[model samples]
Target chain A: MHEHIQPVALEKAYRLLNHGPTVLVSSHHDGVDNVMAAAWACALDFAPPKLTVVLDKATKTRELIEKSGRFVIQVPTVKLLRLTHEVGTRSLANEPSKLQDTGVELLHLAGDTLPFVAGCSGWLECRLVPEPHNQATYDLFIGEVVAAWADDRVFYDGHWHFETAGREWGSIHHIAGGHFYAIGEQMSARPKRGG
Target chain B: MHEHIQPVALEKAYRLLNHGPTVLVSSHHDGVDNVMAAAWACALDFAPPKLTVVLDKATKTRELIEKSGRFVIQVPTVKLLRLTHEVGTRSLANEPSKLQDTGVELLHLAGDTLPFVAGCSGWLECRLVPEPHNQATYDLFIGEVVAAWADDRVFYDGHWHFETAGREWGSIHHIAGGHFYAIGEQMSARPKRGG
Candidate 1:
């Protein structure tokens, strides 16, 4: 792990994904490692943090996750935009060298065999909460976050510091077809003024 | 509908939420209408679009959705920041006049009874898909978008025009509490340069 990487309290893990940034989902199975970009991941619960990510049946990363029953959902910074899109478009099934070709450098978190993509603002290590109906019908997978970490330069004290972190550290939100928007200026709402 | 509000193609409706903006969810049942803010809504599929939103069991809007079997998920703009936080915090169950107190103006879509917040950038009228187990266990609700529309000034031609739509029109993404970040700069990746 990088010196800047720090563990996030499991209780506050949902905050890492609250703002809805496009995430990189990585998994390892049978000596195989894979990563792919997903725009449809969302925080599903708070305590005993759970999240949902839609993994298309076609992606090799999804197959790895099904076999390994563990995956890492990482918030990729603006600097990784090209890498994110490349991994999303290319398939590990067709291109066996996809990860290396896309310039993905994997970093391990101690004892875990799960592959974590470096340079992301945050990483959530999740154990697959198997929901067969959702997976077979909707391609939706649920995971209970067992552990989480953040690159404190961009996220710390249980919140994201995108404004202070340089533009390259901004989390990217994908709309479609290689297009994305980096998270922008922060605004605070006035306390319960009415209603 | 406002002059700028135009119907969005059903196939392109998923693009409206692909960027993951904080949305205003509204529902009507038994002569009552209510709206609440949700940061956890995400597009589930395309081509007869489907979406998922987390509605706490405590929310009155969720109750209405359960009874009526329909709800509207609208992407709110920066202009509605205060309203968004206000509604999300104040429950209609306790505050009988929550909508009016928060200055929410409910607009109707032709014959539809669902209340659409007036100033949102996009509206996705959804039919509850009724995943009872998931809803009960995870407070996760799935909705298939039946009809969709977007304010052409901010979103049109199947894309978000945040840069050209002015700052106030930008989509707001909730972080936690009353804090949020607006959708920022638009970016496009250079087509497939790597392996």
Candidate 2:
């Protein structure tokens, strides 16, 4: 694991994905690991944090996740935009060594062998919450976050510290095709009245 | 509806929510209408577009949606940040007239009494796909896009045209505690290999 990576409290795990950036979903099973881009992931619950991500039925990542019952979601920074786009467009089944081709280093965490993308801003280790009907009907998988981590430079204390972390560390949001938008200026607003 | 609002192709409706912006979910039932801010929303499928959004069981918006079996998701721009934050914090159940207090105008569509939030970048009219288990267990609602529309200034021809659209028109992404990041600069990349 990266030295800068710090553990995030399970209750605050949703903060990692709350801003809605595109993420890389990594899964390992039977000595095979695969990573793919998923823009359709979002936090579903707060405590005992749960998330939902759409995985195409044909993707290798989906197969690995189904078999292993676990997966990791990594929030790729702007610096990894090109690599994210590259991995998103190619499949591990067709290019068996696509991860190597993309030059993305995988880091083995202290306790788990499941590898996480090294340079990401945050990581969410998850255990699949089986929903066969949803999976077969909509290709949606729900995962309960088992553990979470974030690089302290950009995210710490359950809040994104991106204002001073620099633009290169900001997360990427895919628009369409190969186009993406770097998360921009942060602003604060006050409610007009109390509920 | 606003004169500038134009119909979006049903097949490409997913693009509106693909980038993952905080949206205003509006539903009407029993002569009462309500809108609330939901950040936990994302595209669940591509064709015959589907979306999933989290609405806490306590919310009146959830009740209205369950009774009416329909809702409209409006993508608020930077201009609506304050209103978005205000609506999110205030609930119709408490205020009863919260919408009027927020100063957000509602526009009536040609053939439906369901109101759409004016001044938003895109609008998705949806019919709920009843998933009893998911809804009861996770407070999650799934809806299929029945009609879609977008502001020509920010979206056109099935793609987000935010590059030419001014900053005020860019979508708003909620971080936490009233903080938001306006959708920013667009960048494109090429995949290293084909799928």
Candidate 3:
């Protein structure tokens, strides 16, 4: 685990995905692990924090997730854009060890065997919620977050503090092809009275 | 409809919500109309574009969506953040004429009677895909994008061209409380070679 990583409160886990950054889904099953990039993921609930992510029917990650019923969502930083795009474009079924091909390292959390992509700003370890209809129909999987962690350099105290983390720490929001936008320019709005 | 608004290809419609900006869901039923803010929404499919959004069962927007089976998703710019946050905090059930109270104008698309929030960057007119079990169990709603439009000034040729739209035109990404981050800083990555 990275030295800056720390446990995120379960209640506040949704914050990790609230901004809608492109995430890398990591799954391990039967001694085989695979990672794939996904932009179609978001927070689905607040308190017993839950999230939904799309894993296309043909992807190896989807197969691994189904068999193991576990996956990790890793929010890649701007610095990892190349690796993110690489993993997104190539399939593990085609490359067989795609993570190794991209030169992206996988790190295991303390006392946990599941693999998480290195150099990510946040990690959400999720257990599949078993909505078979949704999975079969829409390629969507809903998961209840069992544990969450974040790199304190960019996230802490239930908020993303990227302003001080330097440009490389900003999260990536993919557009299409290899294009992406780095999460930027924080602002706040005041609610009107009685609103 | 704004003169600058033009049709967006259904195949590229997912780009509207791909980055995960906060959305204003407007619906009309039995001569009554309502709009609500949703932060939990994302693209679910590509070809026949589909998206999912969470509307708590208690929300009037949910009731309107259920009754009408139709709704419009408006991607609000940073300038509309206050109004977005306002509608999100107040329920139309309590205020009755909440849209009028917020001072946000509603404009009708030429051939459609449905109401769409003006001053937004993109609009997606959708018809609900009934998933009773999902709706009841998770407050989740799925909609297939039937028609879509975008402000040519901000989006054209199937991509969000926010760079030239000025700061106020950037889409807003909501965080907890009233804070938001304006979508910012475009970048691209190079795809690595195959394994």
lDDT string, candidate 3, A68-107, tens digits: 9999998999989999999999998889878888988988
Model 1: lDDT to the true structure: 0.93
**Candidates' RMSD to native:** 2.4, 2.7, 2.7
Off by over 4 Å in 3: A191-195, B191-195
As a whole number from 0 to 100, the lDDT of residue A10 in candidate 2 is: 92
Give each candidate's interface RMSD in Å: 0.7, 0.8, 0.8
lDDT string for model 3 (B1-195, tens) is 478989999999999999889999998888988999999989999979999999998799899899989999889998898999999999988898888899879888736668899999999999999999989988889999999999998999999988777889999888788888888888889634693
Q: Model 2, A23-121: lDDT tens per residue?
A: 999989988978899999999998889999999987999999999999999899988999999889999989999999988788876377787998899
Q: In model 2, what are the clashing residue pairs, if there are any?
A: none
Which sections of candidate 2 miss by over 4 Å? A191-195, B191-195
lDDT of 2 at A146: 91
TM-score of each: 0.97, 0.96, 0.96
For candidate 2, give the lDDT of residue B192: 44
lDDT of 2 by residue, B42-140 (tens): 999878899999999889999999999999998999999999999999998889889999997988663677879999999999999999999999999
lDDT of 1 by residue, A20-72 (tens): 99999999999999999999999999989999999999999889999989999
